[model samples]
Target chain A: MNRVSAIDIRNVTKAYGPTLVLDDISLKAEANEFIAFLGPSGCGKSTLLRMIAGLETLDAGEIHIGGRRIDEREPGARGVAMVFQHYALYPHMTIRDNMGFGLKNIRMNKAEIDRRVAEAARILEIEPFLDKKPGQLSGGQKQRVAIGRAIVKNPDIFLFDEPLSNLDAALRMRTRLELAQLRRRLNATMILVTHDQVEAMTLADRIVVMHDKKIQQVGAPMDIYARPANRFVASFVGSPPMNFLPVSVSEGANGAVATLGDGSKVTTRVKGLTDSASWELGLRPEHVRVSDQGLAAKVEFVERLGERTLVYARLGDGTALTAEDEGLSRVKMGDTIYLKVDGDAAHLFDADGKGYHTPEVG
Target chain B: MMSPKARREFGNFLFVAPYLCVFLWLLIWPLISGMGLSLFKADLFGGASFVGFENYSRLLQDPVFLQAVGNTFYFVALTVPALAIIPLFLALMLNRATRTAAFFRGVFFSSSVLSVTIVTLIWRMVLMSDGGFVANIIGFFGFDPIPFLSDPNLVMISMSIITVWWCLGLPMMLYLSALQQVPQDIYEAAALDNTPWWKQLTHITLPAISRTVVLVVIMQCVLQFQLFGQPQLITQGGPNGASRPIVLFIFEVGFRRWDIGYAAAASQILFAIILMVTLAQYFVASRREGRGR
Candidate 1:
């Protein structure tokens, strides 16, 4: 047990011939911080994690662990341990051996290796299955063993590549909680790569959202939820993501006024926009209040979850928007309803997809 | 009178009938007949006579037959390890090779396509004691040409080397396919765990492909036990019968000396030895597999 080290990545770029997989990505993780790389599939978040682990070669960049340059070092020399998406536990080795294998290779004494493996197994609650091979364990048990393997290495940083993606929903949730607890217990620097935003939001101290080979935004989960950096982050980070409606802006006395696609105007607190610039009003489903007097929309479908109902509606100009209503609301399909936009909570995106936030009220 | 289900079952039987006929006629019948033949005295031009266990007992005391058995065991010891190990190493090297992997695989495998006779002929020319390719190279290096095929001491070694080269391809391909089947992420995980390359080979690669390794070892044992073609075509088991193999002895006793009964007896003993060895190998391999799981 040594002091956990920070990870610094600078100007890393990777490509497969003509197609760039990761483009000049730069990020840093403080010691003992848990960071999540959150994105859609093929977003190069996984590739960036692999580069930090030294599994994928960087075409151009430098990565430092504890402030030592590791770009040219062998993967074995890099003080990191990875838990693969598929577990990747050796099929032939028992759980004990799988956890101790890397230690054995490093020529650690037998007693020390055993002690570390036992501690890891106890931490992961996998002590009962230490003698069994990976094939005999449940999917969740195997994942725990995969994590235990990383733990026994006592690496400065732990890298997880969608470690819970294979489990069923219930098991995924349980394992995710266990992972969060493990992070607290170990207090090591950890990087998690996942496409599931909920996993990122729940497990990470900070979430780095990526798309199309570049980082879109990086912030605390609540910060990302409240003020997404761009249209892509807004759309990608939330479930049933933010809805967009084309609008035209004009300078108003208080802030700005946006004319919706249906030619209705709403006063918005969002500022620093040119009057002639085309903007889109970004509103989350929950932010659009189903009031009696607002923009006119006809409901197309209703998804009634236990607590809330999602009303999918189309505006007068055929622009689709979803609004969250009370579960007991009698808004049936084809019923006309008015969606009251909370201008303070809504976001404004220009044609280039850059988001403009409202100034905080004193 | 047949029901539809019964008729369908009979139709399924018909599908395998052709293969079954060939199998019984060519393989099973000969195997049974050979076992029966081992217990009696039969000559080429005389009536067969029952001589229970006589041929078997005589072979036990026959020095030439004993020598051939020892020679075959020696060849197996020499070639089987080489066949099992060299190809695996080559496969590991070729596994990581890109762009030229297919070409190298084809080149290495090309020698196996040649008939045993053709392979032996080529090696015989290369190994000739005078004015041969190997001899000339040694001579150029200021050393006298060593007899590869003629000397009694060097003949078996030369034959083992030739057989190993001729049959290296199949086992190499087996190892290659097994290596490919190992998931790539496991290696990546190992690398990230700081396991070095060689340790990764022993701890991960070899254990993952242990089943295939056992198969190649068992196959090489069976193949090298029957060593005949290399020694026969090149040295003709010459220079004091040093390179004579059990199968070659069987051929000589049955065909040249016209002692079919003795040859059959020897063949039965060789078969029993191979069966025992293969079964022992399987038992060890399966036991290891059980412990691993």
Candidate 2:
């Protein structure tokens, strides 16, 4: 088995003239850990990955792979391999040559290079197409070849820059599973940069959520999903997103008593309140249930997905929020319904988008 | 009673009719007539009589014609490699996405807009043996002013220098466009693969633009094989006809000496050589492409 190496990044900053791409950021990855830098478009996640790979120059800070500073080293000398978003396979060369290209460049003997290439091809299930050029393969096969190219290098760190984004939905799912299996088999420290939260949440050992050129939150996938660091991550990481309603807060015994926009009072379990005059009440769709008494809302639209139904509702004061209900429930547009608010599962965000989470229910 | 699809196809043919007419009249008819004219003893007066293969037979023994062919081949040897290599280097230099690269690209491609006569005229002034720019610069180093156009030995070299300078812009542009079409990520991937810049150029850049290289080579060959303007305008095949190319010899024979049939025969020979070379290049390029796949 190959020994996995840890990665350390310190105070990295990158800017393009006047525009700041990556602010001062620091991260550390344990050996054999899979880290995903997840963000929206233009959020510097890919930039950070490229910086770690030594493909992009950093305006400031240092990166260390296996406790040695590699910020000044060339990308190949940095003991890292990168899988590009488009695969970037050499179209003129066969899969075998493409996989062995880096090894050959480093003066590896023909026999060793061929052995490594053959092993990578077998691992990637691309042995059948080793003699074929990239243009002759399907999209998934080409992506496998690209991954094989990175694998044959046997670098200390593997950097994946949205490697599965080009595949179709079905292929992406299958490839995502294969990548997870590969990570387990290789046990190498890998960093993936992607905008898809599901891929980040499902594949990464830890997920670093970034937004607007700064790190928003870094934690395990469920930790981030259950207890988001802020309003942006809360909304960004979840499908259908969390719902927010403007409210005024008051100190209560259990946590904080908040008044919704429609004058409905709800007691939230979130603590550590500094007595804010105005705050936003955040709730996930799964936490809001249809009940007899709570907040009164008019159902504006209904989305009946086969497994679940989503109810888009508006409060008396025109605050909109979506709630999940039984799929076979006969909820229609313009129907008035009362949604029970689970205060223990709610979240409170101050004016600055800082999120305060509630304690877990027993 | 044409079908709608047939009518649409006929309509498309109508769009091409004008060009086809001009092509047949100007190019096709002239080529066929030139071949027929090669079989006759004709001149400017047009009292032509058939002379079966005499012009071709006499051309085989003509020493001056053979020398012109040899000189033309020498010029081809000099200019073809220079045209292929120098422009590619310049294009690689200008391929970077920066203000300086754009400015240099514009500067390099600017010469291609000038007519051949104007280019030769500009070079004549710079290459004049006495009080010329080049001679004066050489004289600054305490060396004698070398005859550029008048000397039999230096005339072909001078003409080659002029032609390469005047015609480099088009191929450079071709390479620049081809270089732009190469994705930036490929080079980044190669860089991460530990490939040096020179290896990247040879292994990645060259292979990616192999088809373009073949195109530029064949175009340069065809253009260089018909070398006329530089030698005719600057050297005028001077100093005992040492710099004379085949095209200039044909001009001398047909217009000056008025041996129309002989001139036509020589032109046919030149055309045949160019055709064979171009077809051979295409053959090799396609075969290599097949092997690459």
Candidate number achieving the greatest lDDT relative to the actual structure? 2
lDDT of 1 at A271: 79
Which candidate wins on TM-score?
A: 2
Task: Summarize candidate 1's per-residue lDDT along A27-120 as a digit string, tens digits.
Answer: 9889999999999999999989888888889999899999999888888788888899999998878899989988888899999999999998
Q: B1-293, model 1: which lDDT tens digit per residue?
A: 99999999999999999999999999989888899999989977865889999999999999999999989899999999999999999899899757698889988888889999899889988899888889999999999989998888889999988888899999999999999999999988778767777878888999989999999999999988998888888777787889999999999999999999889999999999999999999999999887665
lDDT of 2 by residue, B182-215 (tens): 9889988998999988989988999999989999
Alpha-carbon runs more than 4 Å astray in model 1: A275-277, B1-12, B44-46
Per-candidate TM vs. native? 0.95, 0.98
lDDT of 2 by residue, A1-362 (tens): 76678999999999999999999999999999999999998999999999888789999999999999999999889999999999999888888888998999999999999999989988999999999999999999998998999999888989999999999999999999999999998989999999999899999999999999999999999999989989999999999899998999988999988898778888988999765556998999999887777888999999999888999999899999899888787888999998998888889999888889887667
Off by over 4 Å in 2: A360-362
Give the proportion of true interface contacts each model preserves, from 0 to 1: 0.78, 0.70
Q: What is the TM-score of chain B in candidate 1?
A: 0.95
